[model samples]
Target: MKIYHNQLTKTLAQGFIPVWLVFGDEPWQKDNSLSTIKAAAQQQGFSELIRFNTESGFDWQQLMDEYQSMSLFASQRIIEVEFSTTKVGDAGNKALVALAERLSEDIQHKHYANDVIFIFHGDKLDGPSANKKWFKLFSQIGCYLPLYDVELKSMSHWINQQCQTLNLNLAPELTQLLIELFEGNLLALAQELQKLSLLFNQSLITLEQAEQLVIKQAKFNPFQVVDSLLLGDCGKCIAMLDQLQQEGIAPAKIIWALHKEISQLYNMLNQLEQGESINQLYKQYRIWDKRKPLYQHALTHIKLPDVKQAMIRIADIDLLSKTSSEFNVFILLADLCITLYHGDKTQALSLKYG
Candidate 1:
């Protein structure tokens, strides 16, 4: 059966399934869900926990042996299998299907002791993975919980809930600031809230306090890099990119910022070329009053052809980042910044890494 994150507790109250598959890309949600499961399992006297990571060249026989052997430390055991990616090879696919079939057979034959639970977790599941035999079998006999990130439109509510969890009351302005700054990065948002809770001891946080704490805390973020790009400051843009790298920010976040800016510019240019009013477009796009000049500068300096090329290049960069671990995405990102600002890919590449 498929279960949502909200239903996990109720679902666990009924009984424990032989297998549980909790998977997603959201770190905060994934961590919370696993913790909930672990707590529930421990409450049910599943005392011994054995964990395995399916890294490259992992031996399936080891897992099989561990599953078949009895736990020496406790009466019950929980086996956790973590996958780094969904690209589990043919061997893994067969092993999972075989285990699912055995679980189903054991339950049907009343041979299951209800003493051992298997939990598998990993990255987001793609469409093709849903149709795999192993996924279907596991869902039929157990539960598959897939977590999704909160949408930007509903981020304020999420932030409010998180603040309530931390026993901290956030003023309206501070909440809005957090939504704007940490929308996609929930881990960072949680850390900041914990910091606020520690400093103020769960007191209500005012807008001024938040700004004084958060705004001055960082000199570079993905949003700032895109802001510099929109202002046509290639030097500052590349410098921020360097700082972001040195600060250990993920390249995916940088890609998201760049893609968002280029996509908005492309949409604005398309609407303008269609004879739409710039003022109406600005309102339609929800451009902030303080940031209208940045959009205006981008609209004037960036043309449709350049925007189109950038859209394609960013997509390529995103794909390459996901597929090729060794590829330095920052190089292409820097090249993209120069191309978008200067409108010359050849010159951009030649001047930087040529």
Candidate 2:
């Protein structure tokens, strides 16, 4: 039977099926689901693992050979096949259908049903591929799970679910902050959640604590720094800069980040002035829905001329960092943050040395 990705855990808790078909483009969900299946299989004493990857001109006969052969080492075994393409030709299709049929018969007759666990993994299956005879047989005898990408609107809900799984209680605002920070990247978000579980040890995490501990150590990407700056969180902006610097992140990376954000903001402001909707601009620029408010916040404090000037100054900084021997890129970055935070000004701000 077909199963939703979220339902896999509960389904596994109840029992293990003889065959499983897992396919998707979402790496984290796919990986997590596969891990869950493996864990459940291991608990049920499915110890022997036989793995195969279908490459160019792979012999389908090997799959048949392995399936028909009984293991001398273990009573139960997991047979995993990784498909390069879902279109396994006529011979492969027949082989898979036969295997599924045999497993189904074993289940009905109460013989050899507990001997082998068959798992198939590949890219997301299209409707035509999923509707194939072999796939239908597999689904009837087992579970077919397709991992879909989480949309921006539901990202917060997903994160909250993850936090609960990790036993990390987060305030609503903290959840929103995480949504803004991770955006469309679920793998990174999962890793961060793992780290949070270790650091907080199931303690309820407040917004201030999350900002201080979680965001700082979560590998504050350049985009996150820009978000802080745009939101006019001077403390966060400066703190992120320091964290990035101490982590040995290259100055060139920071410079490139500033240049990219300033350029995007400059273009976006000009388009907004031309009577375009924020939603349209977001689509045009490929901005995440969660970040719309931050962009809007930025536009309110930062004028067109300010972004224009910041872009020009960023170019100058880049040139100096590349060519000048005395150029201090970090100091320039700090100055730029101050400029971004306080808005554009005529006189150059005095650089304070730490």
Candidate 3:
């Protein structure tokens, strides 16, 4: 029923299923999984991939008719039903529920014809227990693949897999850099990959080739900006802040990210006091590899109490940024930065943990 991307790929490669449900919060995983499903479906003589949109006032009868009516040209067809968060509660939900119930009903004998295969795509579903009835039924008959974001360290491996799929040579280090610069977002990365696949004639992707791509294709990803801040690079932090301001990433999200990282750093330091090595601790906490240096510096320069104070100060700042009649976002952020730069140990030691 619920399977990882790799497992799903292996199963799908063997043959097509009656249905496939590819949905997740991780964009890259979801897209890549669906792409594999499509590829596998194509190999199984599912030439026609019909996409149905419920948002454009879809005729429910017409869709049912299409599903009922077998393809004259082909023995099997892949019907893609795309349902976003918006349409999920309305026409799309009703249609899918109806379809599921329709297919579940037993015919005159034990046989139920399923010539039309379905692939349902939407936002990441939480869990099978929390999902709707239609979702549960899909798992009974087909595969439910859940995808998560690829880590920075595993980018090279991901690139190798991508190259293998596209049947091209993608440089390892270059792929790693691309993942670093474009981590957390897939739509942007995918577009860049498409460009590279078209432009690069060499079967083997070199680091040099990837470096140019990263510079040109790298837009101001919020995640990269957050990574810089976590590393405590004020120069870069300020530069990214300025770039984000210029590019219009909401200051609220930036504040939230900074606030989260500060808390995490504080927690990491707290754990170190309990006899955790920095190297082991970082990996244990699932800390991003790019954040290692920043945290290393933070632990060396900061004490537990100081971090606690900074966290409290930022919490207050977050509250004020939302409530104060004369709210000053700049002031809040600057204050947080000041504490980060020069907060004292004595006051921090006196503070209580949340």
User: For each candidate, what is the lDDT?
Assistant: 0.82, 0.80, 0.67
Error of 2 at 305 (Å): 30
Q: What is candidate 3's lDDT per residue for 194-273, written digit by digit as tens?
A: 66777875467788756655643334555665566555665655555555666666777967777887888877888899
Model 1 TM-score (2 dp):
0.66
Worst 10 residues of 2 by lDDT: 345-354
Model 2 C-alpha lDDT per residue in residues 159-202, reported as the tens digit of each score? 88887788988778988888766654688889888887888887
TM-score of each: 0.66, 0.59, 0.65
Worst 10 residues of 1 by lDDT: 345-354
Tell me the spans in candidate 3 whose CA falls farther than 4 Å from its real position. 56-66, 69-75, 90-95, 105-110, 127-130, 165-176, 186-200, 203-213, 216-247, 256-308, 311-342, 345-354
Q: Evaluate model 2: give its TM-score.
A: 0.59
Better of 1 and 2 by lDDT: 1
Clashing pairs in 1: 1-139
Clashing residue pairs in candidate 2 are none
How many Å off is the CA of 50 in candidate 2? Answer: 1.0
Tell me the deviation in Å of residue 191 in model 2: 0.5
